[model samples]
Target chain A: MYRGLLWLCFLPSLLFGQRTDSLRIDFRPLLNGVALELEEEGGASAGAREVEVLRFYLSELQLLEGEEVVFAEEDHHHLIDAAQVASLQLPLTLPPGLRYDGLRFTLGVDSLTAASGVFGGDLDPTNGMYWTWRSGYINFKLEGTSPDCPARKQRFQFHVGGFQAPFNSERRVTLAIKPARSISIIIDLDSFFAATDLSQQYQVMSPGELSMKVADRLTRMFRVE
Target chain B: MRQGVILLVVVMMSGLAFTLSSPPGIAYPDHFPTTAYDFRAHPLDSAKVQLGRRLFYDEILSADGTISCASCHSPYNAFAHTDHDLSHGINDQIGTRNAPALFNLAWSTSFHHDGAHHSIELQPLAPISHPAEMGSSIGDIVRRLSEHAQYRQAFSESFGDSLVTGERVLKALAQFQLTLVSAGAKYDRVQAGKDTFSVQEQKGYQLFQTYCNDCHFEPLFTTGGFARNGLRVDTTLNDFGRMMITALPEDSLLFKIPSLRNLSYTHPYMHDGRFRKLRQVLKHYASRDVRPMPISANEQSDIVAFLLTLDDRDFVFNRNHGFPH
Candidate 1:
């Protein structure tokens, strides 16, 4: 009788056979034919020197099918740091047997998470991505040395983040891709440097119109391959 | 079968007794509003709070090992800087704003004079990395704490693991601060029907209800919001309070509304500690050209007498909040 009851409980699971799919995102930081490395000198426009640090938060990942939402990851927050090679590769699990045509994600943390009090994981205050004086997280952090920059060490640091109205820095990216098992996105650093003038605006360590402008520019830098 | 039933009954009764014997978590009066902090996420642990108390008094959090949280926030002053108008940090560097008192933090929705930090757990990061303050990175502190055998053992005991992370440090500090509830004042006693206010205190209480109750509400003694309070800009500091955070012109002079509790201990009041006495604060409020609430000198003294009733002598002298030694 006990064996029969056990079989009754297991029968539904065996019949349905639920399977999980893995989505791996390889974030390649590049400068037009040259992959970027931290603390190493990289060539830029007009004799600009090096790329020292590049980090950003990728959150609210969603898989879309036509106009319908197929899969969404809950509490998804990932911090990508250039110094750590392991951080570049992001692996996420998807619901079983779901076909997705496109991807929708925010390049930065949403306003809800920003307003919500201190949290653990990637959003933890100790991650160095958070601003100490101000409360918001540094959504996108890019620091480097450029000869064109007049600051000490010829360095430029852009820490962009703001969730409040009139200066919200969160940018959303939607990419249409063929239905596939996996996807790879390339973030072109060359385009970012080309559009920004390091000499004119070397540092953006606070949330404001400048940070929003840079965050808006970063929204267009992602491409699916 | 009888023996088995008896054994089960005894086991269940023992479990119920164990549950009843656990120490209480946080205790606040019935009239106070619900705490803003979500305790479900970070449950209270006595071990963690004890570890946090040690970390709060340790100078290892600073770059030069010269300062701790207690340096700026002394327990005698209700965790506020007593005489300093502006806070002094490591290397005797003067900070921009006065260090606010640290109590009833679980009820606070925002932190700092400018409302910069939304969460209490993240507030320590501001002072820890501030150039004028401790000037230490979380990574460096973690590395240092990991090397210390005492901290490692304490971390293991508190968290069931020895590895020190930034999240653990922040959460533990928050745990200790969350326990600093100041609800034992004489005003609280009057509210609970345990005692009665004197005639002078009663008159001051009525005046307070008429003039100050909207912003500095009873129970918590703060509405937990921001207000301008009509203080003109300081030419030297150029500190445009909440405008720096919101970037809105209307928010230019608005600052976080501080609680009225422990007024006697937390002197040199206001965001900049501009007024050393309650009389000056009352004078400023009475003379403000914009929305002035006029009051006579006698009325001002009455308000001061009432404010004194809000002081919780037991909280300030509580040895549990002091150094471990």
Candidate 2:
């Protein structure tokens, strides 16, 4: 009877230890209900617009159980490029039967990485995410053409980045999630257009108050549902 | 005596290992402070430095192959463009600011007058892609270098791979630049107790300590901080210095405080190269409305005489830093 009880106690732990599950985080770029495609005009309240580029760095990803941290990916820096289909999907393995209520992540590179000099992999200088004149990487890049903009080609380029105090453009996002094997995180471009006046403040190639404001708005655009 | 023989052999082997491990480059005086650069991230290799030296002198880095880094940063001029008020780039385009002298770069925390780049490795990208400079993209340079037989071999030898990447290119350039340690000047000799300063030089040194030491510190000759040295805005250029990078109002007109070392060879001083002579520089410092530190003409001449003691002829004429054959 004691042996049977011991087996009963050991079996659950053994099964749980062997049960490692993989979860997929799908980053879907959308304008209302429609999918966002580069160089394609999409409807907005102001007028029609075409997204030329949409790229950003997602870092310090963590899974949380209530207020307690359960799982965290150390040194995780991923560049999500809307132009590339493969970059939109990130696959992560989770511990067996570990209950996670929410996900938290930073929308930019850490200040430590910013000051450590040139890096390879996703943070490579050749990736074009890095600023040529300045040292910091562009945490988020969104370039599009809007009819409301008076600039040449009607282009609006927003390269947001800065790790220094006061002007830091990095944003933290905490998303509540339901228990699921896969999660689709929708990034609505419509909200981004609605939050700012594109005509007056179109080009933001450097770090400043403008970039921080834009980055703040970006933190609100992600929806876990 | 067998144990003694074994000990001698072991010692000889360890000495060989030590020599092989530590590449021959970048020796400074004990008085000099440790460098800001993390050498372990990109360790010094003689082969990489040699490759970088070749790349530095090669015009292939430019879009039209008409300009090179050496074009503006001439070796004889202590790696600074002389005579030109502004740096000249490809297609005869004039840059906005003067090209600063390049030496003792491993110790520098930031690059350019604006302090835009934090890393020495990332600094080259600015000139390479700037329309007013080399007018070439990193991708194009990589492609071009990949096609070249010599560069391909060199890249393979340096990086253990045939691929010529932008990271490797930048790292190699940084390695070559890190080898540029200018601590062999007469001032350095005096500091080392090998020589003595003249009476005029001693007086100037004291004056420099009193008036100039706040920004231009001892040993490294720079505090490596930005300062508003009271130069009026040029109506034509309208350069606001560090404010352009930080977008902060308080940082206005604060350009990088350049090192006093190699000033004898690197003439036409300051961010804009406004003064051709050191006397003019001294005069401006003495007369400027913004926090001016006044010094007499005699004192100014003495300071200039002492500045001449910082000339490192061995460094400027060092064949290693010159054009690779």
Candidate 3:
């Protein structure tokens, strides 16, 4: 009787098959095609800055095939922190046999979620991603030190976020890739820094024209290999 | 028999889960405005509300364990500090701007003097992390709560398990705050036909409707939005108000329009707490340095009489809203 009851519990999963295969969305931040290790001394030069903290929000993962979306993440607002190694990898669950040609995602928190107040898990206010003085989240955070900076302690902080128009910092990034278990996206920090005028325009702590411009350039930093 | 027992246990557990989600306990008169807070997101239960009350009163929320939300927003003063003009934090630290009152917060879409924060659930983070306020981070507070045995048990009762999180803490605090509806004033009684307004109050009400009703609306007693009330900017503070948040010149000198309700309990009006009495606030309005509102001394006294009727003694001293005994 116990065996029969236990079989009934597994019957739905076996017949209708509620099994899911998880696709790993992996991020590997590189400095000139080299892995960026935080707190690594000698990485900074006269103009070049050493990255101390690199954190950002990655949301709404969508698997597409030539303009047609096959799978989409309902609420995948993940806080990817460089300090936490495990946070670099985000897992998106899908049907076991599902397939797609391309992947797309928003580089920051969506406007709808920003207006919906606070939530738990990755979106919690305690994560320090949300702003204290304002109503928006810090969609992307990059902090470092350089010898060329004019600010306090030669440090630079670029916190980009704004939901309102004329200053919204959310960016959409897309890349075509073959079907694979683990999707590895290399973030070319060199391309980002090379494009940035870091010497003069380093400090962008609030959401504005500078933040919007920096967020637009971030889309080109991703390379799927 | 073993299979039957397992089935019975599952059915009983489901019943227990159903009892956990309680009915909405936020009580307000039917005449009040709809709630801006989403009760569906953070449902109000007795256990969670009770837990929030303890946290609000406890000094554990601060870095030096000397301040809480109540330290600045005392219940006796309609959850606003009357002893100090500026917000006092840990270690003799003084913050800019007067701490605003915290009653009927469910109706407010924006928080703080400048309306900087949009969500009440996430609003506490501003004061909790402010350098001159509580002087603590939400992450550190979660760590401290995780180690406490009493809090762990309280978390288990409020939430599902003893695992403490910033989300749970904020939601509980919001639920308690949402329950602080202040619709029991004599004005409400007059509206309900239980009492009648005096002749002077009636004249003041007419004058209020003609002059103040546009910004400080009727029923709720405020528009619940920001306005430029024409107080000369104090050079020492140099507070740009809403302009600081938006970085727009058009939004300069705009501060939140506080409710005229409970004005007697919430003394020292305005964003800077500049006016110690109601007559001084009226004098500034008539002074017309920023905006013109010409009124005689008798008219001002009549307005003060009407404002006094806004004080709700039942709400001010409600034991449920007070510090947990």
Candidate 4:
């Protein structure tokens, strides 16, 4: 009698559903052994400042398996400061006995978001990610002060964006996470500080092609761990 | 038994959906050009349009709750402010540019005097956030709109249970503007060969064809492009039109060519409203000394007559488009 009842329950459960898992994304910005240059002071370390931040937003997250993008979320620009690494928990219901081996996501918002109109909450321009005079959002914003930087005394800002062609820029990276494990992405400041010539690219507050270069260079630092 | 219940629910849902998604009232002239806005991206239901219409006239959009879009763009004046040369906003703050008449904007490629705004869906943010304009942020507007029960219900109906967002707000404004089609003009009748222009109007048409038609185009009466127009820069404002966005020196002094469809209703022409009357505009064009053209007195008169024909009386007095109270 018990076996028959168990079968009755198992039959419908087996026919209708599958197990689900949550994916966690962790972000980290590296600081050690990097030549951190600020715009205000000339050729000095950002470490000299008591408190400094290199913050930016990661938007339009997606999960990819091979060539196919499985999950896509547009208009989500989560700001990650030097203090807290931006993380997201996504509940996913996969096929029966299926395991996702890889994931892909863009580091910045796509062109469509920049072109779309005023959005409220996280997507609003009041968040400081938007440029009012010129239309377009800053995909990545790098702010801090270093003794080496020229604009050291005042708060220096490097907000990068501009999706229009000839200046379009937003970066994406893909990683393999076998067994479908949650991953932490390390944004090595060393790589970014090395790639950009701080003297020429110190205080960018608007969107344009130069900003695209900075964002492209920053995306190269993203890796799965 | 569960399957039967699910089936009943699905059937009920489908019937409800059909009733809510009924077609909207969008009658327009057969001769008008196709609308440039894609309604499919942001579909227009009467509820959303009505909500947007309320927001358009509500003074609560301003930081002080005293100035609304209609404050500068009045429906009685065909949505153009006539009290001042430059538009007045919150705190009686005068903007540097004239408030251009708003109508038939569905066909425009861009917005603003310098074409800084590329899409209709994003245009309201300019006025809403301008320091000299409404001076309110989109976040505050959404929060304020959310407090109202009517707006909440309208938003739910229009956006399928979505929250009141700036995107939805701007999209709704776009929906209302898209319906502002003005094709029932005397010129439209002439185009259909139902009526003929007087001799003076005919002469004006010839003059317009020779000079003004190059920039003002036809039917819509606007090429929707920027031009220098040979106007001297105001020392105080020193507004470098397209250069503000392009950052190119060659594009300096370039301003959007205004539409001449409602010339009779929209007075004080030019970006700054320097010319109060049509005669002044004609005289300016006749000088030709400005743009290196040769417009004689006779040609000037004809062009002015032709400009008057472009007026659409049906648009200015459309009862369907008056105050939404």
Model 3: per-residue Cα lDDT over B211-291, one tens digit each: 798999878887888999888898989998988887778999999888888888887888988889899998888886756
Q: Candidate 1 lDDT, tens digit per residue, B98-166?
A: 999999999998999999888888888889999899999887898999999999999999989998988
Looking at chain B only, the TM-scores across the models are 0.94, 0.94, 0.92, 0.89
How does candidate 2 fare on TM-score? 0.92
Flag the better candidate by DockQ, 3 or 4: 3
In the range A16-130, model 3's lDDT, one tens digit per residue, is: 6767877887899997467888864533655656888889998888999889999988887989988899999987778877878999999999988998766888998889899
As a whole number from 0 to 100, the lDDT of residue A159 in candidate 4 is: 79
Model 4 residue B140 lDDT score? 86
Per-residue accuracy of model 4 over B134-182 as CA lDDT, tens digit each: 9988778888988988888888888898588777887787778777777
Candidate 2's displacement at residue B241, Å, is 0.7
Fnat for every candidate = 0.67, 0.73, 0.71, 0.35
Which predicted model would earn the best TM-score? 2
Query: In model 1, what is chain B's TM-score?
Result: 0.94
Across the candidates, what are chain A's individual TM-scores?
A: 0.86, 0.88, 0.89, 0.74
List candidate 3 segments past 4 Å from native.
A1-22, A40-48, A96-99, B1-25
Positional deviation of residue B21's Cα in model 4 after best superposition, in angstroms: 13
CAPRI quality band, candidate 2? medium
Q: Considering every candidate listed, which one attains the maximal DockQ?
A: 3
Per TM-score, what order, best first? 2, 3, 1, 4
Candidate 4 TM-score, true structure as reference: 0.80
Total clashes for model 4? 15
